[model samples]
Target: MSSPQSRFYAARLAGTPVFDPIGESLGKIRDVVVLPQARAAARAVGFVVEVPGKKRVFLPATRVTSIMPGQVISSGVMNVRRFEKRSGEQLAIGDLLERTVTLLDGSGRATVQDVGLEQNRHHDWMVTKLYLRRIRSGSGLSKLVSRGQTLTVDQSGVKGLFGTDTEQSAALLLASYQDLKPADLADIVQELDAKRRIELAEELPDDRLADVLEELPEDTRVEVLTGLDSSRAADVLDEMDPDDAADLVQELPEQVAEQLLGLMEPEEAEDVRRLMAYDEYTAGGMMTTEPLITAPETPVAHCLAMISREEFSPSLAATVHVCRSPLETPTGKLLGIVHFQHLLRERPDRPVGEILDADRHTVEPNMPLSGVTREMATYNLVSIPVVDEDGRLLGAVTVDDVLDHVLPDDWREQDEPPATTGQIDLSEIARGIHDGDTGSEPAGTAASTTTRREGGRG
Candidate 1:
C-alpha cells in the first residue's frame, strides 16, 4: 500500500490478469488482499483477488507483481498445482484454501469451491488452485478498464464479472460470489490507520464501502465513522444487516451511535438498538435480532408471498426460522429450521416443520461464542438458531461468520495435511503414496475403517 498522500496505491490493484505457467488466462482482479503491514514487512501478507465474475481468490503477498491504480498483477496459480502433485496425495478442501486469498469485501473468511483437479489415464490425480466461484453465489469486483471501455473477452465482446480480456485462454479459472460469503475487506480497512482508512474508504465505491464498513472491527468502525458524513454513515448502516449495523454503532460514542441511528428508519434503528443491549460476543449478540420469522401455520404459499414483500430476499430461507406467533407477540416457539434444499425437495404443500432441521443445535441467549463455535463444528451447520431460556428462536449464526473462528490471522500460511494424512500412519502413509488413496484404497479395508477414516480424510 502507498502513502495516502501518494496518488498511487500499491495495494489497491483493481485490474490484473492472473496467469498459469503456460500463460493460461485466469480471471481479472477485484481487490488487493492488502494485509496489515505488520512491523515493516516488505511485502503484503495476504492478497485478495476477485476473479472477474467470481469469488475473491486470495493470493499471498509473495505472489504480487505490481499494484497499480486500475490493476494488480499476481503470480502463483501454477505453484498451487505443483505443490499438490509433489506431495503425491489428495489434498483437502482446506489445503486448496491455503492460498492467501483475503476477503476484501470486509467479511473475514471464505470457502473452498472447485479445486483445479486433473486426472491422467494413469490415474494420477493432481490438485490445483480450486477455482472457487463464491461461497454461496458468485459476485465480486470488476476490473476497471479505459474509462467506459471494459475488457472484452475473446472476440465475443462479452464482459466477464471483472470484464474479460481478449485472446483469453480456455483454461481460465473462475469462481462464484455469494451474498452470504464472508469477506476480510473489513480487516483490510482495519489494517490501515485512521487516515488511510478514510482515504481508502473515500476511494472505494459507496456499495463497496458499505460492505467493508460492516465487516470491519467495531473500533475501526468508530474511527472510520468520522470519515463519512452522518448521512453516508447512516446509509452504510442502513445497507447492513440490522445486527451488524448495531455492532458498528455500539463501537462509536453513545451520542454518535444515537445520532446515526436517528438518521436511520425508526423501525430498523429500533431493532438495531434492541440488539445493542446484549454483549456482541454472546449468542444474544451473535444472533440477528430481525431475521425473516413467520408462523409455521402460515400457508407456505402465503409465507412465500409475504417473503416477496420483505426488503431482503428469502435467499437464506433455509435458515428462515418459523414460530406459531407473529414476530412481535412470539408464541408457538421455534419448531425447526427450514432447509432451502429440503423445501425445494418436498412439495410446497408440505409443512415447514417437515423441512426444518429437526436436529439443529441452538445456543442460548447468554451462551458464549465458544459454544456457538463448537456447535458450528459439531453439526457442520450452515446456520444455527439462537434461543432464549424459553427456547424461543431469536436469530441464527451463519457459517461464514464462524469461518474466522476456524482460521488464524495468517491462515493462508497454515499448512494443511493431505486427505490421507489422517489415515497415514507408518504403513498406510507409504501405501497411500504408491498404491493410491485417490478413492480406490482396497475396498476391503474394512467398511467401518473406511467409513470413519476415508470420509474423515475428506
Candidate 2:
C-alpha cells in the first residue's frame, strides 16, 4: 500500500476496495490472514476479500501491486474459491483484536485495540505493532473516575497474544462480524478449525446458529449441532425451518434424532416429523412449511406486511398463498396466490382474493423433484404451493430449495485445489514483461503501471 504512513492498522483496512491489474473492481478487504511467529513479527499471508455474492476469497500479499488511498490494486490473478483458514493462520480482526495480553514492562494487562502491519525492506508485510487499551480495575467512584490508557507498543514487548492457547473472547469478534450475512458468517465458521468453530458456535444464539446451519455444508453443521448440548441443539433445531430441520434430523442417527425431536416443542416436532416422512427428493421434502399464507379475505396491506418480515426468504416473500379460514400450513384449501407485484399495485384496502394471479399452478406434496422443477419452470414461478389430497396447502417449494437439491452435494465446499506453477521461473517472466512495458512507456507512466512484485522479494 502506498501510504504516507509507514504502517497500516487492521481496522482502517477493513472495507477498503480492492481492484485488479487493469483497475476493474475486484472486491473489498475483509480481514488480514497472519501467521503468528513465536519470536519475530507475525507474517501476513494474504487478505480475505469479499467478492461479489458475499463470497470471501484469499488475495495473497504478493499479488498486491499498489495500495493507494481508499483502495488496493492486485495482479489480476487470484483464486476465486472460498478462503479457508489454514492451521497456523489467524484472522487479524476475527481472532486477534480485542484479545487480552500482558505488557512486558510489568505495568498491567491490556486489551488489543488494533494490529498494525508494515512492509519490510524485502516488501513482505508483517504485524509489528499493537494498539492497546490498558485494562482498569476498581469499583464505584474509583471505577467511574478511572479510564483505560490506550497506547501503541512493539509486538515484541507483549506476551500471550499469539498461539492457539491464547485467551480470546468471541464477543468482540462476533460484534465485528454481526453485519455479515448468514452465508458469509457460515463461511467464516466453516473455515475455522474444530476448536475455534465450537467456541464460536457456543457464543452464537440459537436463532443465529440456526440460520448459519442452513447455509453451512451438511457435515459441518451436523458437527456443530452435535457439538452443542442436547437441550441447546434441540432449541437450535426448533429455530430452523421445518424442512431444513427434517433434513438435519435425518442425517443424525435415528436414536439421536428421536431424542432431539422429543425435546422440541410438540408443534414444531410434528412439522419436522411430517416433512421427514416424505422422500428426500420429493416436493414435500424440499418445501418450507413457513411460506407467507393468509385468508382469502385478508387485506392487501396485511398480506404485504406478512411478506415484509425479515425472516422470510426472497422467494417466499415474492408471493402470498391465499387459503380458506385457517392461515397456518397445511392451511385450509388453497384458494389461489397473490404476487407481491399485484399486491403493490392494488389499493391497500382491497382484499388479496381480488388480486390473485390467474393461471395458477400448484404441486402435490408427493410430486417428484423433477416434476416440481418442471412445473415451476413452466409457470416461471419463484415458489409453487404444495397441497395434499384435499387440496390443503402443505407448504411451498421455493427456487432456492430446488437449486440446493439439484446441485452437487459438495457444492458448499468451495476450497479449490492450490494453484500449480511449472518449472519455468514465473518471477523471470514477470520481470521480462514489466521490462518490455517500461521500455514502451512515456516518461513516468511506467511507474503507475508497474507491478509491485517486480524488483522485490520473490
RMSD each, Å: 18.0, 11.0
What tens-digit string does per-residue lDDT give for candidate 1 at 295-322?
A: 6655556445444564543434445677
Residue pairs clashing, model 2: 1-67
**In candidate 1, residue 189 scores what lDDT?**
45
Q: Estimate each model's TM-score.
A: 0.49, 0.81
Weakest 10 consecutive residues of candidate 2 by summed lDDT? 438-447
TM-score between model 2 and native: 0.81
Give candidate 2's error at residue 111 in angstroms: 3.0
lDDT agreement with native, every candidate = 0.48, 0.82
Instruction: Tell me the lDDT of candidate 2.
Output: 0.82
